[model samples]
Target: MYDHASRPGKPSSKEEDAPSPDKPPEPPITRIPSVLPDAETSPAATSANNTTPASGYAVGGGEDGGDNGGANLRRASTVPSPHFALPLWRKSVIIMITSFTALSVAFASTSLFPLTSEIAGDLGTTPVVVQVTNALVLFTMGCSGFVWAPVGRLAGRKQAWIGASVVFLLCTAGTALAPRAAEEKTRLKIFVAMRILSGFEGTFFHVTGQTWLADIFEPTQRGTATGFFLLGTVFGPAFGPCISGIMVTYAAWTSILWLQCAMIGVGLVSSIFFLPEIRRPGDTERRKAATSSVLGILKEFNPSPVFKVMLLPNVILTDLTCGLLSWSQYTLLAAPRHLLNPRFHLTTPLVSGLFYIAPGIGFLLGTVVGGKFSDMTVIKWIRIRGFRLPQDRLNSGMVSFFFVIPASCLIYGWGLQYEVGGLALPIVTAFFYAGGLLMAFASVNTYCAEVLPKSRTEVIASKYFWQYTFSTAGSGTIVPMIDAIGIGPASTIGVAFVLLGGVLTFITAKFGLQMQHWAQRKGVGSP
Candidate 1:
């Protein structure tokens, strides 16, 4: 097994990962797996002579939790080789398919809403018992983030996707078909297990899809690509409940899961035929050096890498910021159904469902525009500095984080308290707040890949790790919190979270590179 054996002592400044401004920025994404004596002198080392090191060669980190200097082994486990140089049209297609898959998974996450009672009746249990399953599914999705990368590294990226899809399909089927002929206890247990298992596939799609898009696009254009890719994620949750609400009115509650199954089928079929392999590097020695056995990979598989990644100042701080943002994001999303129906004497599920559309539109506009602006910022920064750093793009999303989200959060929360603008004003605030949320999400999502490109999978996965954790907390507590303190106080709490997150991101944008450089010296990340 490859090990990130740390160098014995603090190294000189020259040993730091920071590159000279005059020289072209070394691709920081991937590396050669084993630090072998004869490896660099071998034929493979000679080949990388012509291309970019980090991006061009397409290496990945090992299961042991650090960069292994390995260029992709066969597109070794998902690192897209720049040598392949896919066409723009082909890359767009890849992004589209992955985005659709992400959307489908996002849909699955929430489509069961308002059906808890119906499902519980079938299982001879209370709606409350069935509803807890939703939270568990969400929790499971977050937990699964840690698994996707290691399994991808061990099996191959394509295989990992296919395997997760297959498992998800089977689990969905099980959840949907909980054996009505069986006893209630038995049926409920089967349904619960299957639903939880299906959760495993959700974050894998969301986080890994981001990394996959990163695999194909360069840093200069990744924000735009990521923004487009986020369409599925941003819209899925918004539409899922609406569609499910309408569907349950007309069809079986299980029909929602069945519909989700059909969507997953479409995505799976598209991927099976069209999703390109991350192609391996050209040299024979490089392939040999990058290769590893599945058993060996699993033996060394330590899930701690996800946690260890948090130790980095940039990662943890940005993640902390993301955590706070998520607290507000979920709060906004969860608030509407609770706020809208009672406030205006709106009784129908459909009417409450309509409220989600406001944020959905905001999410759409925010992602598309935010993505473009982030890329624009990257190009502007590169032109000014003569090179790009991962943190350069963070400045683009600051408007959303600092001004847009905070302001919108306060307005949305307080408007309901004082009955300020009726429903119209609150809907508008929801739209902007949701927009601000995705805008920040787009920036941070792309940054995860660049921050530790070699360990791109882990970095991205771990971000979701913290993101889901905060989101779950917000969803679980916000309604009760509001009931106790009123919407005004609840929103004030959310705004506080937004401001703190904003300050943290500002710190990162300004000093993240220095923090990352210091972490490299301390072996904090794979830098």
Candidate 2:
């Protein structure tokens, strides 16, 4: 619920937002609350709320510290201070632990990729059957966030994580211990069901973790903090198959599940003992007071709100940006084995595992460097304009979107197509392509949270929804497409999508304010 000239996060009186020669102008980044309001904020009512402060404090927080605006961000929270009070160290620890959940879930999703033969043999099925189940796990992991993120939004974030953890642990064990003696059909059904359910439990880590982290972090801190948070998601894919290969060599295929279970066990223990509730104090009592029946509580899980968020012009456009980027992302992740194996005659598991190091290192470098750059970009814009729009962060990713990815992907594709530079060329391109992919992804992920400050949960859910949809499509089709068309041509098609994503980012960055105005006038964002 941002006023056109107002700072982001907290809404305020129009008088406060207006610039004067006497007072300091609005800072580019406004402070967000230490705890987000658990319910949706009515942005359409911004007109009247403009006459009043959002809470007791001035909505414009002190840009330098607790000095300039005389506003404390925590004053925006409705709950008593103690419940939402998290020390700095606690916040870091929580984020660090939450990173592992994303890593572990992503780890479990692909750990079976290298052990398809072992899994199929145990179930008395073909490797193809095992592969299909794994693909579904990845797909379900993305789709499930639409369901679980809303639950975290309406219930407590801590509660949702705890429930998911326990369920995920149980489901992983079910997959691990699926009896070999059973009929193949029964065993496969159990295997698929448990794996899919575990995936469902896993996807919420991104949505819920980001939301909780957002609640505590200020606007300026979000980009770098998010980089840390997303570290797991970007690296997990490359690392998973590497570890999976190692596990199946020395231990049974079930060792992957056991490892996943161990990670879940740590997460469960940490959630109970270490993770503090991010909800407002007495939030439970308030929910009870507000809702009369079990049906009322269950209604929050309905996904229409998520789709409604999808209707916002800027939001939908941003989601499309992510969806298109995913085509390139999964293409990069999926293409190496198919493109490199025959081209370079590299077939060893170690060779395959080692190849990931290039992209993994690139992803690692991008997240940290790109995240810091995003924040710097936002500040640069704010200093120039005397204010910041959420979309200002998009400028930082332009390098990757326009130049790094398209250029690198094309070279990688055609280099393979012509066998021009030998194996080294493809590996080099993978690093740059992967680096560019995550560089573009980092700012976009944070923008999803920023674009709808009040509806961060739904907006982010929408992000993962579209991200995974395209990811699943690309993963399923890339190898076949490469076989049909040369890698260069297929990659060109992917680059076309990446170029479209850049155009979308350009539009959002340029016209985001107007688009938000249009969404409000059309009442698309209204409850």
Please provide, for model 2 over 415-520, each residue's C-alpha lDDT reduced to its tens digit, 9 standing for 90 to 100: 8899998778878988999899888988888888766766787888888888877877887788788999889899999999999999999888876765765676
Candidate 1 per-residue lDDT over residues 317-368, each given as its tens digit: 8888777887887777665767777889976666777777788799888888
Q: Candidate 2 versus the native: TM-score?
A: 0.83
Local accuracy by lDDT, each model: 0.73, 0.74
Q: Predict model 1's lDDT versus the native.
A: 0.73
TM-score of each: 0.81, 0.83
lDDT of 1 at 211: 75
Best candidate, lDDT: 2
Total clashes for model 2: 0
